[model samples]
Target: MTIASCGSVSALTLGLPNSSAVPAEKATLPKGLFVARIPVSAKTKQRLANDIETITMLSLLRPSNTRLAVGTRIPEVLAIGLRLHAKNAAIPTDIVELIAMQRKSGIVFVCVRDADFEGTKRQECAFAVRRALPGRAGHTPTFKVFVSDWKPAGEAMLDIGDPAVDSIDALWESLCSQVMLGSASPTALDARMTRRMQAAQLAEQIDKLTRDHQRAKNPEQRNEIFTKLHKAKNQLEELRKLEA
Candidate 1:
């Protein structure tokens, strides 16, 4: 019921109940929210995406879609799907709660390759998510989930439908179209990317100013551009540190 964790920007739309339906007073359900920190890296996104696509395709190709039922909740369902996909790929994710609960809001998904998914990967992902969260003081219950060590590619392809998009690509597109995982991770990444872009623009401006300052013939003009350049660099540094 409208479960929310502190500092989580990623909202979960799990066909879940809201406060009105589940109610805070009802003590029947779990108390704490689980925050999944997914630390997705740019290096391994394509590989991970392909693997997820393959698993999803295989699942769909199964005679019965509901063969590996996990739970009714969207996260739970996806978690089970991920587990199955990971198992097939020989990937391992060490976490007690496969799915994050509502109590924690921040989940970091990192891109990982098959070779680097083991050891302290989960801790690293969680640390990354915690850094992404706004506050450092609050006690938001959290957990880590690993996406590393996923299969390199699917076993095979099946042309089940009409429009001729590659099955892997199509499956990936379908996963992105989902409400929870789709919106949460991508949206956070989008926000982060936007900040990075802004910082880059500021850095570019500072560089231009530096060049202008050097080219300036007059002392007054040189000093003015230097001041502007200094301010711009400071701003860029601040922007970059927001992620840290």
Candidate 2:
């Protein structure tokens, strides 16, 4: 999943709000800024392993009384952050499980980070949206999850030395734009992932066929390999076009 760039604004420039201004040692968020400081249990921490040092819920956004044109309320949005043990630590992949544990719905803004170094920090921030899948008769319902690319945070603000209120507000606006535009909808991201996987598999198959064609002593075997190679190349080309 990757962030769909908007006009002249780069994705990284509009990444999640830097939590550097929020002290790491304290779980408390800015006064009157957040809704609550949801606790992270020891068992949950164990499940995440040492990859994440802490998980903090900064705020929650709910729909207002006003209804939309669709006559439905906007989904709830959760702003959360995870402090990682190191820069290379894996970002959490089990978003569904995480959301289920929290008993929350709708969109999630995730910010995963490592401690600062040389006045710079390593972070991965993205928005994850969940969609319910249509269930078959007598079958259980499932869900499709879409995640925007984990964009680097605070690069443009590095020289600023500290997180400013305006910068933080801008970050929130960028995040809101993503949700409002539906840029990271499940169908679009899922299709892109499927195309990428197909392209990769085709490339690997073509490479193997090329090697097999060279090693084949029989003319018939070589011709068969060549045919398969041609077909794979065409398929790959089609996928590339879809990507573009």
Candidate 3:
């Protein structure tokens, strides 16, 4: 498995043969495994519309039905394929809202497909992991969401024909790493979220400052805006470095 970093999101490339041969409707898991075709309720679709332009299909992958009893810690896993209108579609910014709409407890992997002006199909895949944090007496539980970048699609197909337990275990293990299920500490994950938010805020601030600097006629005002923009950019770069 090779991971390529694209800004904040990382693309996972599982070097497997015949991955592209399988159709989207086919289960990626080995034959005889429990792959259920679950319905995407109208209400769910409407909620997802906030972030996604269109949803093509949603399927549930249950490890409990397998003979090997994999994914003991995870209750459910979702595979979703979406069609977006945006040419360069990345993971949705408000992914937490999309997670909140889910009734099950587990990770979500999305395959986004869109076409350029030439009508050539382009696909990208990403994963979203959510962890529930303990809340105060009166407050509801808060969730920590970790999203990967939309990478070129291949591993997202998950089309594994091997039924061997070792193969399945290795596959699940790779997925577990993506969500940082047991590998990452809560404090570490929280710090990541903080940095992500800070970076977004700083980027927005820099954009506004740049516009203000451009509009300002007075040399002193322009100089002040430039100073602020430079500071914001420096802070954002530090945050990106930390993420890397």
Candidate 4:
């Protein structure tokens, strides 16, 4: 079963039906299709997972690996092991359905990590898998399930290993932009919008200077480069806002 929410670049994985035996139905199991303007809800989440399972299973007839995520936050693990199906194969129709089913099987994992896994190796990943599989598997694969340098292009299929990643707002004056757009609300979009502006501007400066010694032509060009450097510096001076 192939499940997808196309609008956002999501790195979520839901463990359900093994993609190997699931059947495909084109009308229901569309891959990466958009569901624009639909408000998020419990029911909607369940439905999406179901659809994706169908699609995932549909693809399984071709001999793909049974992979899924186990969202965790041990700081030692990335996503965990499980099979991700596109069709509504192994997935329950609702949160209740899933939880209820867990008593018979196990908890359903939902991955919510970003594109990068922060930098964990295969051995570390194996440890993570062992941690999750306390007593489930009777026959573990010979090869430890881990990637050396996996950088996902799409949220595609992934294991939502263990809970959310521990993110902290390590506010440093350094990352903040030097220029304040205004005394705007601390949570306004206008203020927060400058964050990326600041980051990009800073990135360009770093790149320019690193290559400046190699490719930068002259001092005048360098000064122009520096001017942009500061603008980039103040790109995120404003604050963030939430209207809702």
Top lDDT: which candidate number?
3
Which of 1 and 2 is ahead in lDDT? Answer: 2
Would you estimate the TM-scores of all the predictions? 0.29, 0.53, 0.45, 0.24
lDDT by residue (1-244, candidate 2, tens digit) is 2322211122234332232222323433331222134555565545465555545554333323112121132344445554555664454545334543444343443545554556876555554444444435688757555455555554321111112212322223334334433332223443555576678899999999999999999999999999999999999999999876
Best by TM-score: 2
Give the candidates in order of lDDT, highest first: 3, 2, 1, 4
Ranking by TM-score: 2, 3, 1, 4
Model 4, C-alpha of 151: deviation from truth (Å):
15
The lDDT for every candidate, in the order shown, is 0.34, 0.47, 0.49, 0.29
How far residue 175's Cα lies from its native spot in candidate 1, in Å, is: 9.8
lDDT of 1 by residue, 11-88 (tens): 122221122122223322221122224554453443344443221100111113323222222211121122122322
Q: Candidate 2, after superposition: displacement of residue 93 in Å?
A: 2.2
Q: Which stretches in model 2 have alpha-carbon errors above 4 Å?
A: 1-45, 59-74, 94-96, 100-104, 115-151, 155-193
- Of candidates 4 and 2, the better by lDDT: 2
Provide the global lDDT of candidate 2 against the true structure. Answer: 0.47
Question: In candidate 4, how many Å is residue 56 off?
Answer: 13
Tens digits of per-residue lDDT for model 3 on 1-244? 2322222112223322322222334423321111123445565454455435544224444453333345454454444444444667655534334543445544444546443535675556666555554345688867665666555665443432333323234334344345543232223444565576678899999999999999999999999999999999999999899877
For candidate 1, which ten residues in a row score worst on lDDT? Answer: 54-63
Model 3 ranges with Cα > 4 A deviation: 1-104, 112-187
Candidate 1, TM-score vs. the true structure? 0.29
